[model samples]
Target: MDTAREFLENITAADQGDRVSRLRFAPHKPHAEPSFYEYSVLRGVRVESVRCGSTLYCSFTVPARLIDRNGKLSAGAIASLVDEIGAAAIHKCGKPMDVSVDMSIAYISDAKMNDELEITSRCLGQRGSYHSTGVLIRNRTTGEIVAQGRHSLFSLPATASKL
Candidate 1:
């Protein structure tokens, strides 16, 4: 918990120039914008932690609306959360880099609806044009691995216009 707090504080402090400031929670945060993953939810989403070089943390309180009849977070919603976290982490790596190429995600488990899910993102490595990272989404209460994925992103000097 201390680590999460520290991460949040660091990101907040470092966002003076509006670098990470734009990523903060907004009224539409949980609503899937036209660009990234969109999920229907009763609660909302917020960032838990983010660092300049290596770490990124985010969490979401999944509401009843997003769950399936089985009461678990839908796979699509989980994937969208992962994508948002991953993209944000990548954006913090340094300067904004365009999503020059294709990006993919692989899911591991189903998240329970109304569960508080915490996602941790790490920058694994970067070499030349290739950037590699991984995100692990887990149920904070159960410690169960809800989802995990690796993303291979191509960083370009050009930034893509937001949709």
Candidate 2:
């Protein structure tokens, strides 16, 4: 029995990987720029366009750094994209960003390193301080959907946000 191979195969990738995790085997860097998690998950994203203060488009290439042992994009990376891009859709410049209240993601397929992607986010609407947005992530070359997400947000009252 190859116990070493079995051991290596048994390590499932986590949202926060084991090596650089603050809560796991590593100590705080105190000055890691953008931090490892953000760099791995979000660093290379390119903003394509924004419209009406409610729609956003972006482009990304799945980087190897965010891939798991099986060569698939990590679920956490997809979730982070949905959360950050979804919030950007409804955000008006010069306004404090709304807080994420809920998020639901449907992961559709595997995306590998260097796969080009198109990410689109649109504001669904708002009722008072509550708002909803949807984000779609798809393969730019093959037109296959990789994930869909819906996010809900809540705006803080002006009085409560005063500095």
lDDT by residue (43-118, candidate 2, tens digit) is 8899999887589999999987679889999998999999889988887666767889999999999899999999
Alpha-carbon deviation at 81 in model 1, angstroms: 1.6
Q: Write one digit per residue (lDDT tens) for candidate 1, span 1-163.
A: 3443354556645564575444444354322343222433213778777777868887778776567778888776666565556665667444544352444566666776567888898777888767777888888888888888776677663556587
How does each model score on lDDT? Answer: 0.65, 0.83
- Per-candidate TM-scores read 0.62, 0.75
lDDT (Cα) of model 1: 0.65
Off by over 4 Å in 1: 1-43, 92-97, 100-106, 158-163
Top lDDT prediction, candidate number: 2
Candidate 2 error regions (>4 Å): 1-36, 161-163
List clashing residue pairs in candidate 2: none
**Following a full C-alpha superposition, what root-mean-square deviation does model 2 have from the true structure?**
7.3
